[model samples]
Target: MFTSRTFKINKICEYLLNAKVKRCYPKHILSNRSVHDVIDVDINGVKLIFPNVWLRDNCQCEQCFHVTAKSRIIDYNNFNVDTKPVKVTKNSNSLQVTWDDGHKSKYGFNWLKLRSFSPKYQKKYNDDIYRSPKIVWHGKDFYEICKKHDYKDIVSSDEALHKWLNDTSVYGVSVIEKTPNSETAIDEIVKTVGFTKRTHYGEKFVVQNVTNTSNVAYLSSSLQIHTDLPYYEYCPGVNMLHFLVQTKGEGGENILSDGHYTAKYIKDNFPEDFKLLTNVQVEWSDVGEEAGNKFYKLYRAPIIEIDSNDEINRINFSIPQRGSHFPGSIEDVVPWYKALKLFFNLNKKFAAKFKTPEGNILVFDNIRLLHGRNKYEDSENNVRKLIGAYIDWDEIYSRLRCVKVKLNLID
Candidate 1:
């Protein structure tokens, strides 16, 4: 036997110890359907406890794992990533498992944990904030929902504006209403939020062309749909476009598109093109600023940024302002050009647009949502001008995500 009363941890030689697989409360089980987990076990010589949703991950089912079933097999990507340990209680019969997708299931902890002898999870769990980054769940409908919320309010409070800001990061867009149609108030509204930070963003002219107050009204015309600060090495992390004057033209609409979505749309539809963008890091530059010093930069980032939950986080795209391309060190330039062409076409495909009135503000998660204008011509001398600013994505995301359905949903 391993021990007389209980198994001695060490010191005895394995040959003399005569140890056996008395019981295993491992973490995961591999099966054709998918991997499952265990929380408790009643076997001897072993103990295990499933971590709270912290250890589980989104199911790589057909819905999420759009790849082949063979490729879909649980790989290193499927395990929990934190570094804390979860204990399995010996003599415990049943175990509970909460998945990353907010799913709950129970399995005989022995069944799943035993099958999961592999490095199932690496999450570090403790009742402290110091544990790896706090896992914040941002949903897919965040953008679409926030767009709807923008139209319902007349004047959102300071607290309300911040909540909307956070929603912008989580959903990639947010809206504030009830902004007075005055230049001073609009400027003050954005300034109240303070400038969000980044090594490369917001230090230069954060509010794009704000000093040129003369053309503010004429510029609000349906502006071309394009990303902000694509030329900079570090693009504006977040952008705030506050509209003080909304009623000059009938349909002075603001359009937006999630570059992440467009990139995916092209990737799944046009594989060859998608490969070009992802394979090579495109370079962008900005110059010829008649007013200030020309802004120029070249940075490297994937066009489509998807997070751990398979959700698009940011879209690094600015085709019109694009400069030379840097296909991978080994990659050829042909694919790079091909992907750029495809991205431009797809970006033009399913962009979103919204109309704003006075007292309305549109906060864009510049990393993900690209903004543009339709076409506005001051038939008369009347013009459309908006006061805007740029803030970091982190600030915006924190405020809105906590607003779980309790805040008024503008529907």
Candidate 2:
């Protein structure tokens, strides 16, 4: 009686550790469905039915998976779809499967529970709740928590690097201070994040007030808040601007607005306009000439992009880059402009203004943060110079995930 009671208590503790699975699948079991050619496992409340071939293919043994590299070595083509398990048995905390071809595979309960492809977990994933954690900020208070990291610490310490990456991921922006005021400093910063995502502008673009400007960014004019490369089919995901020289005078502040926050406010206040912007496709193009190089590109997409869960994923609002030709009927054109006007006004209202000093680097999500520059005069002495670059989210998130793994922030 004592031994049985102790075993029951241990099982209860284990279930408590896996509360999510235990709550969903209270009384779980491991069994084989020979007729279906699959293995069945009932996690506390969740039922997982995986194909036999999938089980064999995902085996993590030394022969199947490289322990060092943590990658699969199994030749998937060697396994047939009709593969079936000859026997299935449950050990203390694992399920053992013996294949018809005399292959054995072992999967811990926790691993199987996490890797389960059940409808419940699939629904959770589709719900968009498991995405990178985000902390939305609007107005002046946003500046209070703007995380800043030293350039040296970012390159040297994984902890500091992770903090910067995590802050950028969650807040859509971050500042890197004490950056070396050299042309190559941007490369080091970009390397920290991953790599530069080159565009038609080149691997790196220069941002400075010039006599005869090559692009709007080169001219001393107020740039309306917008995302870069809205004209590209696959717009660059991350943007970084390292200030080599801070401009003198009153009107050289960089404007940054949380596109996600602006869109959410519009959705809540102007539902009709929000719906129109989300549905209508607008043409964005950049046709220009620089150093005898002619460039013209166009792309059509809704100004506001929403995912399946009705959450804002992207905001493409570039007044200068927008093409003259608008899509849809004449009646829809007026509503589209109305929606654009409302959105633009909201962006201006909610934008945060700050002057980036020399040796400071600003990193933001091109997809979620709308950035612009204030008009400034180019005196011989107080000229502004900034080096700009881009990198995709794949690289940024890869680095973030790597750091998170090293820091044990995720399993």
Per residue, candidate 2 scores C-alpha lDDT tens digits across 271-329 of: 99988989999999998876677989999999999999797888898988999998766
Model 1 over residues 206-324: C-alpha lDDT tens digits? 22223344222234334455676565655667776766655465666776776776766776888777666665665665444334444445666666655676555556766555566
Pick by lDDT: which candidate is best?
2
Model 2 superposed RMSD (Cα)? 6.6
For each candidate in the order shown, give its overall lDDT on alpha carbons: 0.50, 0.79
List TM-score per model, in order. Answer: 0.55, 0.82
TM-score computed on alpha carbons, candidate 2? 0.82
Worst 10 residues of 1 by lDDT: 123-132
In model 1, the runs with Cα more than 4 Å from the true position are 1-144, 147-163, 184-194, 197-223, 289-294, 306-312, 325-332, 398-411
